[model samples]
Target chain A: MPVWQRIYEEINDPGFVILCAAQDTGGEAAAGPIFDAANATFIQVVDPDHIISSAFNFVNVPSAAWVDEQGKIVRIDEGTYSKLHELGEGDTKISFGTDVYSVALKDWVAKGSDSAYVQSAKTVTGNIRQHSSDQLKADAAFRLGNLFRTHGYADKAEHYWDLARSLNPDSVNFIRQNLTLSEEGSAGETFRDLMGDYVKSGKDYYRPLDIQSPLQPKDEDR
Target chain B: MAKAMMAYPELRHPFAEKPIHAEGSTTVLYQGRSITLARTGAGAGLLIQPDDLPGINGFTLKPEGACYEDLCVPIGANLLVDQQGEQWFDLTGFADLLGQPYVADSEQRVWSFAEIPAKRDGMMLDAMAPDFKVTDREAQVVSMADLKGKKALIVTWSSW
Candidate 1:
């Protein structure tokens, strides 16, 4: 969160905005404090329904879409991260995210349409995932679960949530969010095993990023 | 991992058990908004009053059809039903016609509909950002249309 705030500040452009959404089924209680701790001035959203994800057809958290001045999507559905991050320690140490994304983001903010990172309309359209009927139904079921969860119908909530996962096994968001409410936690053995099977089944967990590595440093600094 | 990084099993089902809405009313969930319709025609599927159409999904039933912006879907027989003497709109039927997916808990009188695929054709075909309405932390309504003329990076994250 702070990293995004820092980048938002660095960009310092009145025209550039960040709408950072937390896709937490736990709602405000789960996501509010994190945003508060970051002191995020940019638009902050706590989406219990994962409405943003559904609109963009994103199957996971930390996904993003870059909309240009005319409301055209220039880039989208990447495993967006503000910076490369490492967590845990010793044998369990895990690393994810990327340093190049933020750099490319800065370049886009500065150069607009001319930025090398700005993909063409065709590319952007092609990149958007084509969700099938069952996948779409999965979203409906997930939202139904959230509605049930909100109103304290735990049994119905669990039913619809399980239905969602079964309907769209590709939805990492549903899988992780469901796991988060379980005793085993989000990254426990169950999640690990599911991810392993996911990969072995030949699914692209995160669509491979199109950005080049070893990004060239821009002349200007904020 | 920090204790903060663990899943919050405690937070799940935190709300007190209660009836979702008035016993007779129907609740519809769409685009993050939950609207309860106090009056619905007695029918096999969701038969909402024609007047309630716009509030639920922003499509007004016009002479041509249910229209939003420049796009209009022809009102077919499947979308309208007559129960007793009252004319009602079959919202679930309309959803099926639009290839819109939905989950209905008939026992609870609640229906949750996914994004209507037709509403997203602009984005899928032209790279235009699909419109979505969500309230920010400050309780301000934000939508994709509101972000026009600005370069916006809309990103999703999670504590988990």
Candidate 2:
């Protein structure tokens, strides 16, 4: 976010803007600090209900949708975040779509449609799919669990959240949040540890992004 | 008792800004003005007045059925709640009738309803973005329409 804020600050005067829809179910009080700390003043909002995620078909956070000036979506839920560098000191580290995404974003802002980064409409629609029935079910479970968890109903929260996890096991967010809801469900481990376990178990939690000429015809057609 | 809990700072979670339940029989706070739900008899479902249907779940009854946008769940009087001749829709029964998944905890007095799977069937693989609304830090509501004229890069992320 801080990374995008820097880019947003740099080019916003030219009509290049960044808007954020935070996925914190707790809404503003919980999610505002990061925006503030990053000095991101451009239109910031929160999606406690995960509306944007379900609508755009993006499952994870740090995902982005690029819409052109004409209100057409140029790209929906592509790899965001500046994968430019390691996040922490030494062993405690993180890698994101830093330089690649930043360079691509700037190219779009500077060049618009002429930029090679824009995607074809067919490819855009093709990338999304009818999420499995379980995933749709998971959305409801997450909604219910989020409500209970926010209201201090620990056990009730666990019931639905655990249901969410079972319904959509790849959602690490659900697992981390559920672990805190009940002792029986608790892992008392960090997100890194649990995310590692998910990886070991062969859950494709992180999406590998291929953003080059995303609009071009599929290889089969060409 | 829930209100009383909200009144006490120590009783409330230090970070939460809103109460779970409002101070009347007409509301359960999850979003917006909250939903109007009444406990009808010793049952597993919630009863919402037909006139208040839209606010409760965005379902509007028409000549055909309980319609949402272009989709409708065909319902009849059989699904209506009855208490001394006054009637409302049985939320659970309506969902069950439509074959949609839902969960209600009578003990917690809370429930959740999911979108009909058919909606996803229609929505999946569509290129157009689904319209959604959210609030800024100042509590002002913003919708997709508000950003109509400009190029937008919408990022969905979290602090945790």
Candidate 3:
């Protein structure tokens, strides 16, 4: 929330708006305190059932889709950074995305649709892959699990979560939320155990935007 | 005000009550609707009763195809797989062929289906944003339509 608030403040004049859709199935009761405490001035829409995730074809949170002033999705990346990264920040393992995302976001806001970050329609569509059969099933399972978990049926929730994790073994996002709920508000040791495996696997785990692609630079085009 | 779900602990499908089961048959709830899966008389292959096939997944078995209105996807002999001279429709396998996604917990006998994306073939940018209603911090209802014509940097996030 701090990161977003900073970005929103930086580029609000250029018609840049940040709409944070909190995907908490527990509704406001679960997500309210965090945003309320943040004193966020930007738009905060509580996504009760994850309608945005299902529509955007993204499975996890902290994932952002860049929409242009015309309302077309310009870019969608998982590891969207709020601040430019500094040296040793990677070692701290605190920030998610690199400095490139913020740079690109500002470029888009300043240049409008003409920004090189604005991908072609074909490219955008091609980049957006539909969820695989298993992933789709996992989405449903996770939804069902979330419903049960929030309703005090931890045992029942665990059953569905096991099925979801089995079907989409790589989905740490789904697994993390479930574990956090059961572990009395902390992801705890289960998160560490899962992270160990996740790191060893070394898949495209974060799914960051391809930063190497050239975008308009302030001085000249890269 | 929406009552907390736990306030109604007894909530369940009306048909979720105990039902008579055929010999050697297992029950699975499809979309919260109960249906029995019976094993083929020959080698073990699962089949939904012909009469109950429509209820299984809303596919009306038509000679033309798995007819749902005018759209009939021809599953052909592929629809019914034969194992050891006994024909049975493999529910799991059929779902894969249709590109429909489903989640099943065999132990709990629950199967859930998800909607197939209608616009995946390269119209994402041109496609209009899907509208949805959600509540603000004050619990007042708001919707995507309320912000029409404005660009939104939609962020999907979790507090954890």
Best by TM-score: 1
Tens digits of per-residue lDDT, candidate 1, B57-91, equal: 99999999999899899978767888778889999
lDDT, candidate 2, B1-160, per-residue tens: 2221101222113334345654434333323223645534335566767776777666788988899888887887777767778886776687677656765655555556666555454334445555656677778887666777667888877654
DockQ, cand. 1: 0.78
What DockQ, between 0 and 1, does each candidate earn? 0.78, 0.33, 0.22
TM-score to native of every candidate shown: 0.95, 0.78, 0.64
What docking class should model 3 receive?
A: incorrect
- Of the candidates numbered 1 and 2, which has the greater DockQ value? 1
Over A63-164, each residue of candidate 1 has an lDDT whose tens digit, in order, gives 999999999998999989899999889999999999899999999999998888888878888889999999988988999998888889999999999999
- lDDT per residue for candidate 3 within B89-131, as digits (tens), equals 6665556666767655444444555544432332354634444
TM-score of chain A of each: 0.94, 0.79, 0.78
Q: Rank the candidates by TM-score, best first.
A: 1, 2, 3
lDDT of 2 by residue, A1-222 (tens): 777787787676557667788776555665677788888888788776676665566767777788777666666655577655566776878654545676777777888877777776666666664466677677777777667656677666667777877887766556543333323232334455877787899755545555543333222211
- Residue B21 lDDT in candidate 1: 91
Positional deviation of A215 in candidate 2, in angstroms? Answer: 13
For residues A1-222, what per-residue lDDT tens digits would candidate 3 score against the true structure?
A: 777777777777535567787876555666777788877777787774465666666666677777755556666745666655454445665534556777777777778777766765555565564567777677667656554454455666667777777877766566655544442333456676777888788855556566563543331222
TM-score of 2: 0.78
The candidate that wins on DockQ is 1
True contacts kept of each: 0.86, 0.50, 0.44
